[model samples]
Target: MKKLHHIYIISAFLLSSCSPKISSLITKDYQSLKYDEKVVVLGLNEQQPANAEVLGVVKVRDTGFSTKCNYEIALDKAKLEARKVGGNTIKITRHKKPDLWSTCHRLDATILKI
Candidate 1:
């Protein structure tokens, strides 16, 4: 029974550690909102939403977790932050590469709404 418990605990830890996560740091302020499925991620030079308004900016942080985290995770986190800041769209404007192990990443983006 003790061996079984140990195995279970280790398994749980391993599983959790395998998942990727990213966080948002507010660079601008706006009315708080709940991110919706309608939110869109605009291209670097997407021209369609030229008239879209800027809500704010956010700095996305991700500690490139043990090969578990990827670029997509960081980008998604930035988009989510944009949505929460009362925007419907997100456009990453800058990127900071991580160290040799990719243990840290920073993404700067503009939050916009149509």
Candidate 2:
């Protein structure tokens, strides 16, 4: 009985530890911009030095902009970049004005990692 109980507890702990957390954020935003905009560069860091990596890309809703692009970088990098730019803040910069079909908006953010 004790052995079975120990196995159950270990299994539960492993399951919880393996589960990945799903989080989302809007790295860039363009409000009422007629032309499309492009992001030139992005900087990311962490509050408490930690290694980070780019995960993937996240889709952002169109807010009357030309084109919108979002990226899923490492959480640690995101947090660091965020703190650098503006703690818990998102920064958006436009390189060129929108044309018609698409507007370019770049995402420059950082977040904490595990």
Candidate 3:
């Protein structure tokens, strides 16, 4: 019974390690931009460009099962969402680093068109 319990725990760990990250976006009508256009990333305290137009909000997070939830991966996911909504820049609003409960980076960002 003890060995069976260990096997179950190992199986659960393996399943979680293979899970994919999740992302969400909320936006209005905006023309999608070309992939060739570079998407700029802004820090939490960074000031947005004066001529920038707000496009939408983006969030990337670990679903408790996500494995490769690193900062770069999360940021890239947010940028992809921004590009889909015609945003040329992303302003990071909240960043949650890996903690005891989750071994993944999470972020909330505001998409903008400059």
* Model 1: worst 10 consecutive residues (lDDT sum): 61-70
Candidate 3, residue 82: lDDT: 89
Instruction: Indicate which candidate wins on lDDT.
Output: 3
lDDT of 2 by residue, 5-109 (tens): 999999887665432222345344323222222222333332323443322232222244222232332233333334332233332221222346434333333
Please write out the lDDT profile of model 3 over residues 3-63, one tens digit for every residue: 9999999999888665445455565637888877799999989998899888778887778
Q: Provide the overall lDDT of each model, using Cα atoms, as 2-decimal numbers.
A: 0.67, 0.35, 0.83
Over 1-114, each residue of candidate 1 has an lDDT whose tens digit, in order, gives: 999999999988777665444445555556656755566776556554668777767775543344544567667777777767777778777776666656655677778877
- The TM-score, computed over Cα atoms with residue i paired to residue i, of candidate 2 is 0.21
Clash count, one per candidate: 0, 20, 0
Local error of candidate 2 at residue 83 (angstroms): 24
Global lDDT for candidate 2?
A: 0.35
Model 1 regions more than 4 Å off? 1-36, 63-68, 97-101
Q: Report the CA-based lDDT of candidate 3 relative to the real structure.
A: 0.83
Best-first order by lDDT: 3, 1, 2
Question: What TM-score does prediction 1 earn?
Answer: 0.57
For candidate 2, the per-residue lDDT at 7 reads 100
TM-score of every candidate: 0.57, 0.21, 0.77
